[model samples]
Target: MPISEEHIGRTYPATAPYEVGRAKISEFAAALGDADNPAYSGTDPVAPPTFAVVLASAAWGAMFDDPELGLSLSRTVHVDQRFAWTRPLRAGDEVTATLTIEKVRARGTTAIIGIAVALSTTDGEALCTASSTLMHTSEEDAA
Candidate 1:
């Protein structure tokens, strides 16, 4: 099934606020081969640049779950991801993310979907914006 064009500009609901923790930040740094930098992995209050993924992972589901879009996760391939931070997020701060479908384009048996998720505080302060570009190739196209 093809993804519906109508859902292109739809904005999904905000996810529950998440509190950043030092442990999680450390874990991410370790996974990325970073050996705990002071600004990102210390007890202080700074997070790595890519810390936005914590909220993005929670927000991307809204796009894949769009019932009318008929997007098949199994057939999707993450093409690229970009993030623009208005400010860095600190541990222990609660933040929410709202997902928006930015664009959709089809190519042969494949499709490209762009989604932008905004991470912000509960009081409506903008934190950062993450954009994901996904390529969906039908099984037939793979074969």
Candidate 2:
């Protein structure tokens, strides 16, 4: 089934707060092979720019779990990602992510979905906007 265009402009509730910790920052940096970077270590360390994905992914769960959307994780391919940040994410910050469906387009048996996740502090400070484009192939198209 094709992703419905009606999903566009829908906004899901904000996710539970995720606390940023120094150890997690270091761990993520190491996974990126950037452990040696001073910014990822010591007191007052900031997370890598792309670390917002950690929170954004959790927010996307709302969309994926919506039965009415009929989205299949097995058939989805993440094609693009972009982020706009007001400031770098730092350790000790409590963050929440809210996902919004921005656009949906169809071509043949495939659908391209655009989603934006807004990351904010528990206190309501804007952090970043993470946008992603995903392509979902119908069962027949995938075969």
Candidate 3:
């Protein structure tokens, strides 16, 4: 079965607040081999730009868990990712993310999904928009 085109433009509810912490920021920067950057360490550190993906992934959980969406994580390939930031994430900032289905295109047995996650402060200040493209193959098609 194919993913319904009706899913396009569907926006999932905002995820629970995720508190940004200095340790987590340092960890993420270290994973990227940027641990030595001054901005990513010390008493007050700003998260690396791509760190929004952490919050965005939380928002994506809603769509992935929606039975009606019929998505299979095992068969999905993340093809692309882009982020636009209003401000860099900082430690101690509590944030939430809301995922929106931007576009859904079917190609043979595969579907290309375009998704955007809006990351914001718990107080509702927009922080960043993380967009990604996922290629998902239908179960029957994969078999």
Highest lDDT: give the candidate number.
Answer: 2
Per-residue lDDT over 18-97 for candidate 1, one digit per residue giving the tens place of the 0 to 100 score: 98898887787778888546777556767787889878879978777876776767888889999999989888878999
Candidates ranked by TM-score, best first? 3, 2, 1
- Give all TM-scores, in the order shown: 0.89, 0.95, 0.96
Candidate 3 stretches greater than 4 Å from native: none
Ranking by lDDT: 2, 3, 1
Worst 10 residues of 1 by lDDT: 35-44
Better of 1 and 3 by TM-score: 3
RMSD of 2: 1.2
Cα lDDT tens digits for candidate 2, 21-59: 999999999999999999999879999999999999999
TM-score of 2: 0.95
**Model 2 C-alpha lDDT versus the unseen true structure:** 0.93
Clashing pairs in 2: none
